[model samples]
Target: MTDTAQYQHFNVFLAHEDHKSEPYHKYLKASANYETYELKSSLEVDGILYVKVPKTSQPTWAKFAKSLTNSSIDELQNNSSSAVLIIRAPKATMAVTFGYGRHLLDMECFVTDFGIKTALNTLNHDTLRSVDVITLDEQGVQKKSQASRSSNVGVFGIDISKDLLRGVTGSSKAGVGLFNISGSGTTFSFGKKIKVKDMPALVERIYSYYQSNDYKDSFAWVDNIRRLEEKKDIEPLNKKLIDEISKTNPNIVISIPEMLDWDTITGFSFTRTKRNIKPTIDSSDYYSSLDKDNLSIDSLKRDRLFVFDSSDEDPEYKLYDCLYFEIKGSEKTYILFSGTWYEIADSFVETINKLLAEIDITSLEFPEVYTWQETSGKGKVVEKIETEGDYNERAALEKNYYVLDKKLVKSSRTTTSIELCDLLTKDQQFIHVKHRKGGSAGLSHLFAQGNVAAEIMLGDRKFRVAARSVIRNKVSKDIVETVPLEKLDSTKVEIVFLILGENSSTLKGNLPFFSKVNLTKAYENLRQKGFKVTIGGVDKVVKPMP
Candidate 1:
């Protein structure tokens, strides 16, 4: 055979069929066309293993039975690992339970790799390729397959090693802990001493985390288990859920903080409002590599935020409730939940007012503030107009200042406030933010300032304006607050741009060149200039001559 055909990798399926064609059996068979095999002397295959586990093994299976009674689940089986070897395919992979029966004295082995190999006389070779490996709990069922953990769910076989828990939260010998934490604020706290029924789900979560080496953020998962003992709501743990959590930006990640703000009204003051929104902001002056990469709507999902825009079928229609939050100690932020923009903005202002009025801020000098920016419409992913001289362009400027031409200045009228609103219109949409405790040092303070670069094609001709950032006591400032209202003279400006809307096919006109910029890049450019900015218009549209 040719080299390509002579040496090739094959996905392997290993399953125990003691319960007939139940879920596990069907799962494997349907996933990869896995055929059954037997360990008898007459039946053999080069690289496949299908075990039929006899009825006698079922009881033992729930206890600590590892592999099939024979070397195979079916009539054909292979014992060696070769080019074509057994492996858990992505789809067939799951969190499984492994432990000795509750009644088995001195037979306390878990279904770890060591235990599995010993039972089947096999080896699990390490392969660099990423693949899914589903394992079962000793209960002969899946942990995530259950509906809820509040109703006396049993875990069968699984125990957390005291040493492991100690290393994570510095809690030593804290008793075999089990918890159930749900989104609905229900909680069950079991301090060690776990039972078989409470062991499966816990063990599965731990094992999955261990196998994936994704143990860093086990707090949330462990918290879910902790709530189980207290008869509280339980957040379901599964591969899919874990994957979503893992995808968010970790450097600046933080748990949702409890609201502590209580204050009065008008503009951006914590004195008139309470802090109800929780979001994580950049810890440093600039963006980290991880934060930069995940600014996309796709990554926002991991942050518990869903962002989407309307389609051709519904332009003015919104999909869900939108929530907005601003990072307290960082540069102001404009976040939109994927929902109706106007409604979210109104609720945001009201919630902040109520929250502030409820807290004690006598000693706390609230650093940053959040308020609703009047936006034009409700849409997914809204922000202020983009402009040049944002955070990304900070490194590009030779000095602290940049120049804007007079033509780009247009009229003297411009929105001087850095805060603006953008709306998201998708279900389950929210933003996670972590801000500095309470000080100006906490704000990212990134900003953008610019005048119209050139006049738009009112019908045809282009007109230029002057606007850009200039050194204000050595720090870059883009706004010309004192400019003449009739004919502003802007020497420094931050150029704002947008991208073409996805539904512009029917519009019989050309879009402005400034409309094609990406949001993150645009914001970064303005921030570099030391001009705080907010963005809007996820897709692009005609710019109003503000």
Candidate 2:
């Protein structure tokens, strides 16, 4: 806890599965390009460093502090730099890492999450510092929390403790790409500061604790989590995602990622729109080297974004901000969230599917009369989609559904414009049709739009006045006779979201996981407002196979 115990603040690492047999130095390399380090732990080298000697980086600001003009600053300040140190226990397979040496080891060579398990083994009132967690969802969140104070700090966050915990690394945070990973019982990280007169003793204690299995299940309530990066664990998962990105498909979506968990931070106000998410359009702009075989996390550090408004202070984001990818294999479904890929648990996926089934999205058969033509891009894949205006007009003429697509009416309530619906029917079904291409983000926008239009139509009289005028004059006066505006019953107004796509199947299985969250929220709100809500799907027109 003091300067006397310089090695006190260190991270404990367990050798990756079967990596225990390898020489201690084999697991990590010295970061200095032109230098080499003796892999053994020499007590002379800061009592823990594996390098031949203690290599303290010279702080660039040290010169200014020692200058003749103003040379009175007592303590020398050092900016962050990395140094490698690893101490392996003579008894078992454990490595004690000090300084920034944790970065030098390959993720495949050792396990980092055991540190959390060690924290739980501490006495109930012992000094526990912080906890990190990753959510086992497609959102791929990583969060570091110090919710507990020194005295009240137990094994977990008591009031904040919930279930569904897992272990993962490689997050896409806003500035440093921190994925909002989820918590307690089992955390992504757990640590407490303690003095160690000898480094080997600390290694033995951890190795014994892991080997004993006594306290292992003493916190069995917290073992609901598992780590995948212990040994070559993430390679296969990364392989699947890389394949999708190298090609083009919904399996991988590379766009501007929204910032997460900034709302809870106490410093300043932050909004999603405050910093525009720059889409990672072309990968070549960030880097010329595209590794098809291996992934280098450092490459992403160079890929940054600076286009936040000059006048406004905001979270600095990277160009390769965040990525979302999902793949259904022969057995389990895998989701790549943030920068880490996790295997979706079978029970978890089933639980979600069961919940989704109860949501009751009405699937009315849509009229399939449209055709697609080669307007741009690839062969049959890049066919120009029929616009909403064209689709509604044709549907009205050919099928008798009233076209209300572009009848934009300025609302007095919101002081903004509102489009009632794309098509209206005699039975009071107000349908909103949209082309499904932007993945979940596009669908979320549509759901929100549909929900708002329904709210405006039902709640606001002025919105209805503008809606009535636009429908009567712009859309059709005769159509209003069937569904009168003066006595528009909220119950009879059916809000339908007709999503058109060539490959999407019935808006259920193919719907991105995150979109389902938005869809459920919109659906519940509309239903609570006493309006009938239904999800409708139509096949998009695609170029005929030659």
Listed in order, each prediction's TM-score against the native is 0.21, 0.54
Score candidate 2 by TM-score against the native. Answer: 0.54
lDDT of each: 0.22, 0.53
lDDT of 1 by residue, 1-546 (tens): 211222211111122222222333333323232234422333221122333222222332433333536444442333321121122332222212112111111111111122111111111111111111111111111122222222211122222210011111011112323222111111011123332232334434333323342222322222111111111111221222233334543222221122222111011111111121112222221112235433433333333311112222211111111112222213222221121011112333333344323322121111112212233344322233222223113212422222321122233344332111111011111111112221111111111122111112011121111222222222233333322223422223222322112122221112110111112333444445443333211222334455
Candidate 2 structure lDDT: 0.53
Summed over model 1, clashes come to: 126
- The parts of candidate 1 lying over 4 Å away from their true place are 1-6, 10-26, 29-35, 38-525, 530-546
lDDT of 2 by residue, 1-546 (tens): 222443233445677557777765576654433224553333432223443234455578777658855646656654444554555556645544445555566555665555444444442323334445654332345665564444333454431112223322222222221122222322222232444435556566656544444434444534432435532656676665555555523345443344322112111111223222222122333323345354444444334533322245545444334556776666666665445454554554565566566555554456643544432223322223455566678777766788887678776756567778888887788888765544455566677778888877776766677777777788778776534556568787778887765333556776766566566667778888888777767765443466
- Flag regions of model 2 displaced more than 4 Å: 1-8, 30-48, 51-99, 112-231, 236-332, 335-340, 359-365, 374-382, 396-430, 448-493, 502-507, 512-532, 541-546
**Worst 10-residue lDDT window, candidate 2:** 262-271
